[model samples]
Target chain A: MKLEDQRTTVYKVDPDHPETESLPTLRTEELLLNMGPQHPSTHGVLKVILELEGERLVKSTPVMGFLHRGVEKLAEGGTYHQFIPHTDRLDYVCAMYNNFAYCRAIEKLMDITVPDRAEYLRTIVAEVQRIIGHLFWLGTQALDIGAMTVFFYTFRDREILLDWFDELCGARLTTSWYRIGGVEKDFTPSLFEKLKKFLEYFPPKIDEYVIFLEKNRIWLARTRGVAVISAEDALSFGLSGPTLRGSGVDYDLRKYEPYSAYPRCEFSVPVGKNGDTYDRYWIRVEEIRESLKIVTQCLEQIEPGPILADVPSVTLPPKDRVFTNLESMIQQFKLFSQGFEAPAGEIYCGTEAHKGELGFYIVSTGGGNPYRLKIRAPSFIHMGAFDFMSRGYMIADAITLFGSYDIVMGECDR
Target chain B: MHAIAEKIQEKFPAGFLNAQEWRGDLAITVKREALHDVCTYLRRDPDMDCDYFVHVSSVDWPDDEERFEVVYEVYSIRKRHRIRIKTRVPEHDCIVDSMTDLWYGADFMEREVFDMMGIRFRNHPDLRRILMPDDYTEGYPLRKDFPVQGKGWRDSFDFLQDPN
Candidate 1:
C-alpha cells in the first residue's frame, strides 16, 4: 500500500447497522488538549490546540500573540532611530541580528551606504549572534527532549559568548549595538583578541555537543525521521535558514542575496538529505561551524577604520564633536529631533537572521518615520505549518517537532 | 522583471492595473477580483513561476477611495526572481481572495492580516485571529485610524478574568 493511502485510511461506520450499534458502542471522540501558553516544553508562551486520537495527533492548531507587543504599530509612531531598541526586544536571544536586520532595512530605506569596516564588524557580530542563538536553541531543545546534560554543556559554553556581547555592548540580552548607518562603535583591541579566542574555541565545542547527541540511541530514536518535511513542502511553507536547509533546500538569503560582508566571505551552505528533527538538529550544529568559519574570515579581513558611515546627516555626530563644534551640535540636534527623511517608497530587506529570513517590509511616505512596517518573522511563518508537520505523529514527537522549528515567541508574536 | 510584468499583462490584461519598480523589485498592481487567478498563474506558469509566498500584509490608506491596500510578496525559487502584487480593497467590502489553495503557508499570513487589518479572505480554510485572542472584540489594531495605546483595553482588567 502507498504511504499516502495508508495514512489516509478512513473507516466507514454504518450508524444504523445492528452490528455497529451493538458492538459495545465504543465511540472514540477526539480529545482536545491545550499544550501551551504556560508549559515549559512548549517553549515561550506558544499555545497549541491539539486534537488527539490516543497518542496520534489528529490535528493541531498553534495559538500565538501571547507575547504580542505590537512592535509593528509601535514602529509607525516612533522615529527610525527610536525603533532600533525595540527591534532588540524581538528575538532577544539574538538581539544583535535583530538590530542588524532592522538597521539594514532602514539603511536601505534611506539609501545610506555603510562603511566597509562597519559591514565587516556587523557581519562578524551577526555571526557571533547566530552562534549564541543556536547555542540557546540547542540547550532548550535538548532539555525539551529529556537530555538535561546537553543543556548544561551548551549553556556553559553560551555564557562565554554572552560575556563577549556584554563587553561589546553595555547590555547583554538587548544589545542594540547596530545603528542605521553603521555600528555604535568599533571593537577594542582587547575585545578583538577575546573574539579571536572565542572564534578559535567555539567549533570544537559544537563538535563536542554533536558527538554527545549524534550516535546516542535515545536521541536517534527520538529525532530521526520524525516531523519530516520535504524540500518542496518546506519552501511552500516559507521555512528558511537552517529549518529550510535541513529539509534539503538550498535557499539561504545569505548565499542567494549576499548582503553586508557576506559577499566577501567564503562559506558553504550545509543541506540535509532527510528533512527530519535530527536533520534540523545536525544542520544547526553544522551551521555553528559555518558561522565560526565566517567569523574567522571576518576577523582576518577586518581593519581599523571608521565604524560609522560618512553620512553625517543620517548618523548622529560624535558626542565629543557635538560638544566642541557648533556645526556638530546642530547636526546631532537635527538628527535626533526631525530625523533623516527617507524617500517616499516601500522596500523589503531580508537578512538571514539566526532563526530564518528576518525580513522587514518598510513603507516610508517621505518622512523620518515609516508609514507601515511589517516584520516577516520566520518563527511566525514556521508556526503556520505546525499543524501540518505534527499530524500523524505521536504526542511525544510533537515536542521534537516544536524544538526543531527553533521559534522565539517574541519574534513570532511581534 | 519588466518582461515578467509584460507577460502578466499579456496573460491578464484586464486584471493588470499598473506596474512599477523600486530598489530593483518589480511591483505590479492588480484588480482585487483577479488575485486568485493571478496568483494561480504566478505559481503554476512555468515562464513566470513564483512558488514561494513571502508575506501578505495590508496598508491602511483611510483617505484613499479604496481605504486598504493588500500587498502580496512572492518569490520564484527556481527563477530567483521576486515580485510584489498590490490590490486595493475598500473599507465597506473588506473581502479578498485567499492564496491558501496556491500556497498553504498563506494560511497564517492571511489570518494575521485579517486579525490586524480587518480584511477577510474569500476561500481561506480557517480564517481566525492567530495572534489576538478569539474573544478579542476590539477594532483591528493595524488600521491607521486606530489609536496607539488603544481604546481603554489596557486599563481594564476585565480580559484577565474569565467571563464564564
Candidate 2:
C-alpha cells in the first residue's frame, strides 16, 4: 500500500537540511526521511536532514561542507594572485563576481586601480553576469514551485548570456576574467556591440517573466506570505542582497560602497515591502531591470583605452613588450615569479553580487601572497533565515523559501 | 566626498570609525574596546544608524599585536547608510562579547562566530562546532596559525561519512 494511506511505513531522512525540531507528537507514531546529497532537486552535493510528521516537515537542519575543500584556508597557503582562481569555485553561478570581489580587494590593498575603460567594461560584464544569475534563480525557483515551463523560457536567455561569457573567457562558469589591477584583456568591440544588443532586447524578455509569473494568481498564492522574515531578523542573521532588500532593508554595497566605477553609473536598487518568498522573487525581477539600466549606461560610457594599468610592478608586462624588451621581460619574470607585494594592511571590499553581498577580506603582510583571505558568503547567512522563517509553514513552504533566498551551494559550502 | 557619506566625515574625526577620505573613498578603524559603544551609538544616534547587521566576519592579523579582527558591518534601512566596525582580538585568547542580547537575530550569528572563529561569546546560550563535525579536534581553521587541513590532518570523528 502507498505510504499516503499507510501510517506504519517510514521514509529516509533528507541529508542536506533535515528537520531540526523535536516533535513529541511524532515521538509515538511519526516516520522520519532522508532527502539527498545526490538528487535532482538537491542540486550538487547538498543534503537536507529532514524530520517529518506524516509528509509534513517537523524540523530541518542544512548539512553543508559536503564538498568543502577548505577554500578559505587554502587561500592562506596560496599567493594573493593565485587565489583569484580559487574564488571561482564559490557561487559557481556567477564566478565573475567572485573573481571581481577578490581582485577588487587586492586592488584596494595595492592602492592600484584599473583604467576607466576597464572599469566601464567590468561594470558592463558584471551586469550581464547579474542578468544571467537572476535567470538561473528564476528558472530554478519556478521549477521548484511547479512552474516547469518557465524554467525553459528562463534558460533560453541564460544560455545566450552564458555563450557571451564563453566568448570573453575560455571557461563558461569559472572565468577568472577580472584581474587584480584590471581586466585580463581589452574585450573586442564586437563583444560590447553584442552586449548592447542583449541589453536592448533583455528588458522585454523580463516583461515576459513578469507576465508569466509575477502576477500569476497561482504563483503568488504559493509565494505570498509563505515564509515572512521581519527586517530586523533578516539583518540580525547577516542578510544581504535581495533578501535584506526584500525585508525593506535598503542596503546595497554597490550604492553604499561602490567599487569598479559603480558610482559613475546611475541605477536604482529595487526593494520589496514584505520579506517573503514572493517579495524575493519580485525583487530579483526588478533588479534584472536595474541591471539592464547599468548595462545601457556602461555601453554609453565605454571608451577606447588601455584596459590594464601601467604599473608593471603589479600588472604583467604586455606580451609585445615581453617579446621585444629585456626590461619588460624581466618585469614580467619578476611579476610572475615573486607576485605583487601589497602594503602591510588588511581591508575588506564587498560587491553587491547576484547571490548577495559577496565580500573578500584580505590580510596583506607586505608580501607577494596574502597572509589570510576570508570570504563573506551571503548564502550561509541567508540560510540562517531559513529555520526561523520556515516554522509554522507546511513542508512545501521550505522549497519556495529556499528559492526565495536564492542560495548557491558553492558559496554556502565555502 | 559622496553626498551621503561626506556629511558623516564632517561630523566625526578623520580616524573615527576607522574611515578617512582617501581619494574620495572611505576606510575607518575602531578599537575593540570602543567597538560596542560605536555600534550602539550608530544604532541609536539619528545621524548614523547603519543598524542592519549586513555581515560579521573576522580577518586573521598575524603580525600585528592583535592577531584576529572581527568586523561588524551595519546598514540603516531607513537612511540607506552603511558603516563598517572592526574590533581586534589577540591570538592567545580570542573572545568577543555577545551582541545577541541587543539583537535576538544575532543568536545564531554569535554561535556561528563561536563555530568558525572559536571566539568565545561571553553570554551565548549554545556554543558548539557548526559546519563541522561535533567531535572533530582542531584549532579554529579561520585563524592564521591553524592549518587548512587541520594540525594532525587526521579524521578524529566519524559522525559524518559513516556508512554504518
Candidate 3:
C-alpha cells in the first residue's frame, strides 16, 4: 500500500461545531505502578503497588515479607538466652536497642531486678544507641529527599558513637552487650572518657545537621504537609515513637510505661503538631538532643556496683568469676545449656525503640524455650496505615512517607 | 479481679470464661462467639477507652480440647492501662471475629496471626498471607507441629545439586 493510503482518517475536527461531536473519546484509567522490592529509596526490600491517577497516588498496597527470616519461629526452638543475638537482626540499623529490649523482656519474664549501676549503664548505652538511630534516620531521610551533604555530616558524627560502641562491646552493628538480667560488662575508664568526649562533640554537630536541612527549600517543600495523619488515626493505627508523636500524640512508652533508667533521666519526649513528614523529622532531631541529655544525666548519676544481677539461677556469672571459680563455671554451663525455667504464663513487653514500640509477646510453659513468641514490629504496623496516609500525595512523595516512619524491612517482614 | 475484668464480666456474664492478673498484666478469656462484642465494648466504652491496638497473636496447644488460643492485646492511651483478651478455638472450627473495623492497625496484625497460626478471622476486609508468599502451601509455621527446619522447600531447589 502507498504511504498516503496507509494513513487513514481517524477523527475529523469540525470548525463549525465547537463541541467536536466527530472527535473520538480518549480512554483513561488508573495506572498501576510497582514501587520496589529492590528500589533504593525503599531503604530495604519493600514493594508497594501504587495505583496512580496521573501523578497523584490514588491508593498504595504495600507487599511485604521479602525479608521474612521467621525470627519468631526460631525463638521457639532456642532457649531464652539464645534469642538475644537473633534480636540484633530485627532492626539491623540499631541492634543494641533490640538487645536491650529483648533483655528487658526476658528480665520481666524471669522477675529479676536489674542492679542499680547496671540499670544506669543500660540507660546510657541505650540512649547512645538512640542517638545513633536518629543520626542514621536523619542522614538516610535527608538523602532520600535529595539532601546529600546532611547524610555525610550525620554519618560522620554517627561513626564516633559506633566506634565508642566498638570499644564498649566487641562488634559495632550486632553488639549483643545486654544480658538478660544486666549488661555484659561495665564501662572502663577509657570508655567513660570517650563517651564524655562524644557528649561534648555531639551537640554542636546535631546543630550542624539541622542547619543543613532545616532551611533547605527542597527539603521543606518535599516533607512539609506531606503524608499527614491525624492524632486519632495515628493512635488507632498503633503508631509509636516519633511517627506517632509527629501526629501530636504524647503516647511514648518511655514516658508512660517508664522502663529501665528512663524514669531516672530528665529528657523530654518531643511531640509535633502537624503530623506531617516535616514534623516527624523535627521530632527526630529534637529527640537526638533529648537523647544526648539522657546520656549526660546517666553518666553523672551512674554509680559503681555489680553490672550483672546476683541471681545464680537466672543470670550469668562474670567472665573473671567463670575462669577462677568452679561453682561459677558450673552455673554458667547450666544457664547456657538449659535456660532458667520461666514460669508458666505469658507476658507482653513493649520497649520504645527509635523507630517505634518494638514489643515481644512470649508465652512460656515452664520451660527454657518459649511456647510461642510474637514480635509486634512497629514498621509492619506503620505500613498498615500507608494506604490511608499516601492517598493524595504525588508518587515521588512515597519515599518521604517511608522515611517518615523510619521503617526497617528486617523488623517489618520478620 | 481488676476493675476492667469486673466490668467485662458484669457486661457479658455468659461470655466471660476466666480472668487472671499475672505479672501485672490482666488477661481475660471470653467465649469465641462473644469475642467481637467484648472488643467492641472495650473500644467504645468511655471507662475502658482501649483505643490503641497493640498486637494480635495466637498460641497453639495440641493436647488441649481447644487446640488454639487467639490473643488480642490493646492499650488505652487516655487511661494508661492494657488488657489482653483471649478466646479459645477448636481445631475443626478455627475462626474468630476480626477487629480490623474497630482498629485499623488490626488489619496487618490479624493478617499476621492468620498467616502464622492458620486461624481465620471473620469479617477481615483483605485477609491474605502476609509474611509468607501468596502461594505458600506448607502448614502454619508457629504451630507446634510445624518443624523448625522448614517443609523441604529448600531441599527441592535445583541449585543445591552437585554439577559433575
Candidate 4:
C-alpha cells in the first residue's frame, strides 16, 4: 500500500463530522536533552541543556560550576605569594599559562621589570605550554568528531613536552615555575639540549597529525561551517585568542599590547576568513607552528643573566642564599609568613593564553591579602555566547562547539 | 586624565563624579542612575568606541554609604584603549542597569555578579545564579560577611546522614 493510503487508513475519517481533515498531523514538541555534567567530551565537568527540534539544536543553556572551588574567594584569604599554587588549579591542563598570567598581573601591580634572560625563559616555557594545550585540544576535538588516530598521534608528541616540563620543574602538570618577578630557575644544559632536539622533531609530527584530518571526508564535514560566528559578534561577545582570531578579528594581546619576550621575537599571528570550527582548528594548528618559531628565536637570542629580579621587598631570595645567610633566611621567612605589602589600588592585566585572554583584576587596600581578586577567565566568557552559536546547528555539533572554545570547567567555574 | 575619560566627563557632567588613572589603567566613577547612559555613549560614540566587553565585577564596601561598587571594564578593538566604568549602589537598593543589550557577552558576566555579590541587574533577561546552584538559599558567597568555610550546608546534607 502507498504511505499516504496507509496513513489515511490508520486514522479513519469520521463520517459523522462533515469537516474531517484528509490526514492527521503528527504532534511535535521540542526535545530537552542534557549533554553532560559528566560526559567525556565535555573536557571537564560541564553540563549543557540542549533544546532540540528533531536533530537540530534550538537553544543551549550551559549549566556551569560543577568544578567551582571559589578560587577568587580563596585568593582573598591567602597572601600574595601563597596564591601562586592556587592559580595552578585554575586551568589544570595548562597550569603554566595561569601562573604566567597571574604572576604578570602581580608584576604589573608592583611595577617590577623582569630581566631580559628571564623574559626569554618565560616566553619559551609559555610557548611550550601553548603547544601542549593545542595538542590536548586537537587530540580531544578530533576524537569527539570520530577521528581516533589523530588523538594517539597528538598525545604521543604531547608526552615528550610533559616530560620536558617534569625535568624543568619537579612536577609535570602543575608546574609553578613562574614567580612574581621572574622564573624560579634557569634552564640547565640538558634541558636546553632536549628543547633544541624537540624543536627539530616537532614540525614533521605536526604535519603527520594534519595529514590524518586535513583531507579526511568525515573530519571536513564535521568541522567545516560548524558554529560559525561573525567578526562583529565575536568582538562584541569578548572572544579572544584563537576563538576570536578565527573570526578574522586580529586582536591578539601579544601583538597589540606586547609583553614578555613576544615583542622581541618575530612571528606572525594566523587569522582565518570563515569563522567556523574548521577555521578555529586551523588557527590552533598554525599557532602551534608560530609558537615553535618563537621558541627557536628565544633560544638563539637568549644571553646569560640573572633569572630572578633582585627586588628584596617583592622577590624571594635564592635557595643558596636563604640557607647560607641569616638575613636572607629572615627575608624569605618574612615574605612567606607576612607577605609583601601591596599598593592600595586596582589593576587589570591580560595575558594571551592558548585558549584565550586570561586576565587578572586585583584590588589591593595596602595589605598582604588582596581585598578582591577577579579572574576574567576566557572559558567562562565564551560560554555566554553558547545559546546564540549553538542554535540551528545539529545536536551532535554541541560537542564540537565545546571543543572549539577549549572550555576548561575549572577556569569556567572559578 | 585619559582622552576618553575627559570626553565622558564633558558629555555627562552631572553623571560624572571622578576619574582615577593608576598603573596605566583609567577608572571612572559615574552616578548609578547614569551607568547605562555612559556605557551607551561609550559604545555608540565614534571617538569613544568601547565595543569589546572585558568583564563585569562587583566589590562590596560594607563601611561606605554605597555598600556595593559595580565595575564594567571595556576595551575598543579598533582603538585599542581600555576604560573601567564604575558605579556605586547602596545595600538596600543594590541594583544596576543591565549592559546585556550593549554587549551580549555581559549576559553571563552580569549573571555571575548577581550570583556571587547579590547585586541585581534591572533588565537582565536571565538573572539567576550562574556558578552557584539555583536552589541555593544561603547568602551570596562573595559577600564579606559570608563565611569562607561556606554555610556548612554540605555538612547538613541528607547524603551525609547515616541511613538507620
- TM-score for all models, in order of appearance: 0.95, 0.83, 0.95, 0.95
Residue range A241-283, candidate 2, lDDT tens digits: 8887888877788987677778988988888998887888888
Q: For model 2, what is the error of residue A89's alpha carbon versus the real structure, in angstroms, after optimal superposition?
A: 0.7
Give each prediction's DockQ, rounded to 2 decimals: 0.53, 0.27, 0.54, 0.55
**Per-residue accuracy of model 3 over A1-414 as CA lDDT, tens digit each:** 122322222333455886766667866667778889999989899888887778998878888999999999999988899999999999998999999888888888889999999999999898889999999999999999999999999899889989988998888899999998899989999999999998888788888888889789999999999999999999899999999999999988998999888898887888999999999999999999998899899899988899999988889999999999999999889888898889999999999999999999989999889888888899999999998999889999999999999999999997
* Model 3: per-residue Cα lDDT over B12-84, one tens digit each: 9999999998889899999998999999999999999999999989999999999999999999999999999
The worst-scoring run of ten residues by lDDT in candidate 1 chain A lies at A1-10
The candidate that achieves the highest lDDT relative to the unseen native structure: 4
Docking class of 3: medium
Ranking by DockQ: 4, 3, 1, 2
Stretches of candidate 2 off by over 4 Å are A1-35, A50-59, A214-217, B1-48, B59-68, B77-93, B104-109, B149-164
Give one digit per residue, the lDDT tens place, for model 2 in B39-125. 666667777756576566677667899877776666676776556566788877788776665554465555556667777766665
DockQ of candidate 2 compared with the true complex: 0.27
Candidate 4 wrong stretches, greater than 4 Å: A1-24, B157-164
Model 3: clashing residue pairs?
Answer: none
lDDT of 4: 0.92
- What are the TM values for chain B, all candidates? 0.93, 0.73, 0.96, 0.94
What lDDT is reached at residue A7 by model 2? 33
Candidate 3 residue A247 C-alpha distance from true site, Å: 0.8
Two-chain complex of model 1, DockQ on C-alpha atoms against the true structure = 0.53
